[model samples]
Target: MSTPTGFMQYQRELPADRDPIERIKDWNEFHKHLSDEQLRTQGARCMDCGTPYCHTGMELAGSASGCPVNNLIPEWNNLIYRGLWREALDRLHKTNNFPEFTGRVCPAPCEGSCTVGLIGDPVTIKTIEHAIIERGFEEGWVVAQPPKVRTGKKVAVVGSGPAGLAAAAQLNKAGHKVTVYERADRLGGLLTYGIPTMKLEKNVVDRRVNLMREEGIEFVTNTEIGKDISRDELLKEFDAVIMCGGATKAREVEIEGRELNGIHLAMDYLNGTIKSYLDSNLEDGNYISAKDKDVIVIGGGDTGTDCVATALRHGCKSVTQFGTVGKAPLERDIINNPWPQFPNVYTLDYAQEEAKALYGEDPRAFSVLTKKFVGDANGNLKELHTVQIERTVDPETGRRIYKDIPGTEKVWPADLVFIAVGFEGPEKTLIDSFGLEQDRRTNVKAAYGKYKTNVDKVFAAGDMRRGQSLVVWAINEGREAAREVDKYLMGSSMLP
Candidate 1:
C-alpha cells in the first residue's frame, strides 16, 4: 500500500539559484541552498516508484543511463523528509564518497530516469543531495575516521583525480597504506583544476582532501612517474599500484590553422587559470587568461560550457559556442530523442544563461564545423573560418555521418579559441614506461573487473582505463579497484 501520496498528487519545487548576470561577474557558486523546511518538502515529492530506475545504473538505448554509483536515492529522500539528515547523509555516503562534488557537477542522470518525471517534473535529487552533505559538514558530523588497523600492505596510486581519491579512500579504509602521487602541485586533479570555480569551489575540494589526509591517505604532489620516479621504483616500494591518471590528452580539431598561437586545449586553459588563482589570485602567469578578447569555443559539451562561463568571468568581449551536431529540440518526446531515458533536449545551462543575459540571445551555433583558423602574420589567431553542416544516418549501417553544406562558409571574429571536442585517452609517457597494452581507443588495456595490466602488480582505473568519463564513473572505478586490491592483498575482501 502507498504510505502517503499517489501519482500526480505532489507538485515539484527546487531551491533557487543566484542571479545569472550577477553570478557571471565572479567565480563563486551561484546555487542558493534551500532552507531545511523547503528541502523536506522537496524530498516528500518522491513518489517511491516501484521500479526505481533512478539508482539502477542501467544502460538504455546504447547509452549509459541512471546513476553509475547506484546511490540509495529513495532511502535518503525519505530520511531527509523526516528531518533525519544525519541518517540521510549516512545513506548518501554509503555509495558515494563525495556527494558534494557530484551534487554540484554531475549531469544528474538520476533525475533523467526518475519515474515521477515521466508525467511531471523530476524530484530535486541533485539539490537535495547538496543540502544533505552540506548539513553533514555544518553539524560537524563529517569527521576524519582513520582506519582501526593498517594491513601492512603498501599501495601506490597514480593520478590524484576523483578516481584516484575514491580508490585511496576505500583502500585506506581496508587498512592498506595508500600513497597518492599527483603530477600537479596539489591534490584533486580535475576537481582541483579542470573544473572552473564558478561551478565547484576549490575550498570544497580542499575540505574533503583535508579529511582524507587526516584519515591517513598520504598525498605526494609535484611527482610525475617515469620522469621523477621510475615504474621499477613503484614496483619495489608498493605491493600494488593503481593508475587513475585521467584522459588528459584532448581530442583536437585538425584544421588548416590548427597550430595557431592563440588556440589552446580546454584543459590547458582551465588548468592554467585554476593554478594561477590558487597561487596568487590572477597575478600568477601560469594560466591562460580570456580577458577582453573575442572567444570562440569549439564543441558544445560541458567543457565548452565551462569555457564560456570562465571567459565571461574574465571579462571577455564576446563568447560563442559551436556544436557540430544539429541543435537539440526544446522539448523531449519529439521523436528525435525519446524519454524514459536521458532526454536529448535543449536547455540552457548556467553558462548559456549568463551569455544570454549579457548578449540577449543564446550564443550557440548548431551544425557548424570549423574549416580553418585564420591567423595573423605573427602566428596569432584572429578569426575562425567555419561552415554550416548537416548530419544524416547511413541507410546501411544506421550510423550518423556529418557533411559540410557547401556555400555556407563564413569567418567569425576570434582572438582566442578553446577546443573542447573531447579527450582521446591518457598520456603515453607512463604507458610506454610501464609497457602497458592499450586498446583501440588508446585507453589502458584491462578487463572491466580485472583492472590489472599485463604487468602482475600494476592496475588501472577511471578515464585511463575506461576512457574520458564522468566523475561518478571515476568514483565507481576507484571503489571497484580498491575492492580488487583488497582481494589481491588479503586473498579476499569484504569491501563492496
Candidate 2:
C-alpha cells in the first residue's frame, strides 16, 4: 500500500455531476472529472484489506459479490496513490479491455463488496478507474497493438456488443484474424443503440471501435448471421465461430390493447431515438417523440430508468416508472443481506435524480403491476390500469412470489407507454440455424469456463450463454471464452 494510513486520512469522493436541470436540456454525459491530485487522494483510500474481496468476482447470495473480471483493484489503487497514472492504466487494461465503458456504466459491484463498505463508504473505485483510462487516452498511451505474428487462423464473432468486442480484441491478440458481424448499422450493438447518448455517448463507443480496427479486427455492420449471411457459409469460411449475439429477445407484456399506438418495447424506442440522433440530431422525426405526452414506463431497472430520462428529455409532460418488486431498503439490513455480498440497498441513479429535479418528486412507483392498457377508439393508448402487489416467500422454494392486492386497482392517464421489463434470452434465429443446444432459459447451452457449444468449432459467451447480465460480466465472458476458443484452435492458449 502506497499510503499505509491513507484509508483513515481520506474519505470516498467522486467527481461532481452537472446540474440536473441544465443537463436534462441536452443529451450529453453529466459527469465532471476530478483533478489529478483529488483522484490520487481518493485512490489512497483503498485499505488493501487482507482478504480483499473487492475483486473476488464471486457469486454470493444469488448476486455478484465483486468485479467479475477480477480486476487488480489494489495494485491500481496503489499505483494511482503514488501518482503513477500510466502504470495504473496498464494495470487496468490487463483486466478490462474497455475501462471507459465499464467505468461509465457499471454499477460498481466491487464497491458494494469493499471491506470498508462494511463500516463506512467504499473507495471511489469507478471514478478512479475512469481517471486512469481517460488519462491514458489523453497522454496518447492507449494505442493499437496488432499482433506481430499471424497464426493463419480466422474467427467470426457474431454481435458487436461488449462481449463480441472483447472476444475479438482477445482473439486478435492471439494472432487470429477476427471479424465481428453486427446486424445493426453501427458497430456497437447495445453500447451504440440500446443505451442513450447521455449515459454512454456513441462517440466513446466509436473511439474504441476505431482503435480495434487499427489493431486488425474487422467489423462488418448491417450483417445478420442467419438472415443476411447463411450459417453454412459462415461456418465454411471461418475456422471458428463465437456466438456473442446478446440476449435481445425482450420479455413481452401481453395484455389487451397491447397493439395500440403510442406503446412500444423499450429497446425499440431507445434504438430508434439513438439512430435518429445520429442521423440528423432527431430533427428528422424518425423517432417516436414523448413531447407533451404523459409517459408510463413499465419496469424499474436501469432500462426503465433510461426510458424515464429519455422521455423527460423529449419534453414529456410527466413520467412514471413502475416496478413489480417492493422498494429496497434505504440502508443495507446486515441481518438479511450480510456484508461482503452485494448490498440490496436503494440507489438514486442519474435518471432518477434527473426525474426528481424535473418533476418535483421521484418518478418510481414500486410494487405495482400493470393489468392492461386502455386505448381510445383510434387505437392510441390513453390510460394504464394497474394493481398493487404484496410479496410473500414460498415455503417450498424460498423464492419471493407476488400476490395482487384486491380492490387496489388504479388508473393513470398515459399517452405514451414504454415496456422496459427486461430480456428473456438470445434470439432463436441464429441458435436454431446453427443447431446449438439451449438451456431451460433459452440461453445457448455452453458450460462456463469451457464456452464450447454442441457443434464443434462453435463457441458462445456473454448474454447469449449467461442470459441478460451486466456489461462487466459480458466482458469477462468474452475474455474467458476467447481463451477457450484459442485453446481449441491452437492446442493451447496463452490468454489468462
Candidate 3:
C-alpha cells in the first residue's frame, strides 16, 4: 500500500467525460482524462484493507463481486499512487491481456466490493486502470513481445470478442500458434459493432489487435466457422479449438405486429450504425436512420441505453426506453444488495446520461411491459402499446411476479423500435454443425473449470457457454479455457 491513511486522505474521483450534447454530434470517444497528479490522488484511495477482495474474482448473488481476470488491483493502485506507471502496467498486464478494453467498457465490479465502499465511496479503480494502460502506451512501454519458443501446437479460437481475444492472447503467450476466427468483416466482435463509438473508439480496438497481430496471432475475419470453414477442416488443421463465439441467439418477444417494417433487433441496429460509421463515416446510406422519427427502445441495461444514445445521435424526434423490471433503488439496499455484490442502484449510464442531456429527462421507463406493436395501413410501425405492471417478489418462493394494473395501458408514438430484450444463447448453426451438446438454457454444455466439449480437443468458453454475461467474465472464461487447451496440447500448462 502507498500510505496507511491514504483512504482517509483522498476522496474518490474520476475524469469528467466530454460534454454529452457536444459529443453526440460525432462518433469520437467521449472519455476525457485526469492529470497525472489527479490520477495519483485517486489511486491513493485504495486502502491497506486486510485480505483485499478487489481481486477475489468470484460471484456473489449471481453478480460479479471482483475483477474476473483476478487483476492485481491493490498492487497496481499502490504503484500508481507512487507514480510508478511502468510497474503498474506490468502488474496489470500480468493478468489482463487487454486492460484497455476492460478499462473502457467493463462495468467494474471490483469497486463494488472494495473495502472502502463499505463506509464511503469506492476508489476509482476503473479509471486508474484505464489511465495506467494509456500511460504505458504513451510512454512506449507497451509493445508486442512474442513467446520466445513455439510449442508447435496450433489453437483455433472462434469469436473475436473479449473472450476469444483473451484466449488467443493466452494461447499465443503459451507458444501456441493461435488463429482467431470471426464471422464479421472486422476482427473485433462486440467491440467493433455491438458497442457505440462514443463509448469505445474503434481505433483503440485496432491498436491492441494490431499488437496481437504483431505477436503472430492470425485473425481470419468475415469467415464463418460452419459455412466458410467446416468443423472437420478445423479439427484436421488446428490442434485444439476454443469456442468463444459468444451468445448470439437474440431473445425476442412474441407479440402482435412484431413483424412491422420499422421494428428491429438491438444488435442489428447497433451493428449497422457502427459498421456504417466505420466504413463510410455515415456518408453512405448503409445504416438504419432514426432521424426525425419517434424511437422506442424496449428493455434496459447497457444495450437499451446504447439504443437510446444511438437514437439521440441519429437526431430522433424523441426517445424512450422500456424495461420489464422495476427501477433500482437510489442507494444500495444493504439488506438484499449487501457488500461485495455488484450494487444494484439507479444511476444514469453514459448513454442514458447523454440521452438525458438532450431529452431533458431520463429516457428509461421501468416496470413496463410491451403489449404489442401497432402498425400503420402500409404495415410500417406506427405506435407501441404497453401496460404498466406491478413487479413484486413472492415472500416464500423468492420469485418475481408481474401483475398488470387495470386501465394502465398506454400507446407510445414510435415510428421505430429497437428490441434489446437480451440473448438466449450461442447461435445454433456452428454448434449444430460441430454436433456439440447443449444445456437446458441452449448454451454449450461444457464444464466451467473443464472447458472440454464432447470432441476431444474442442473446448468452449465465454458467453457461448455461460449465456449473456459481462465482458470481464467473458475474458475470464477465455483465459481459463486457453489454459485448459494448453494443458491438453502439452503435458502441463504454466498459464494462470
Candidate 1 residue-wise lDDT at 182: 96
lDDT of 1 at 265: 92
RMSD value for candidate 2: 1.2
Q: Which ten residues in a row have the lowest lDDT in candidate 3?
A: 42-51
Can you write out model 1's per-residue Cα lDDT over 347-397, one digit (the tens) per residue?
999999999999999989999999999889999999999899998888989
TM-score of each: 0.97, 0.98, 0.98
Off by over 4 Å in 1: 1-3, 334-336, 394-398
Best by lDDT: 2
The local distance difference test score of model 2 is 0.93
For model 2 the TM-score comes to 0.98
Against the unseen true structure, what C-alpha lDDT does each candidate score?
A: 0.89, 0.93, 0.91
Superposed on all Cα atoms, the candidates' RMSDs to the truth, in angstroms, are: 1.6, 1.2, 1.3
Off by over 4 Å in 3: 393-398
- How many Å off is the CA of 441 in candidate 1? 0.6
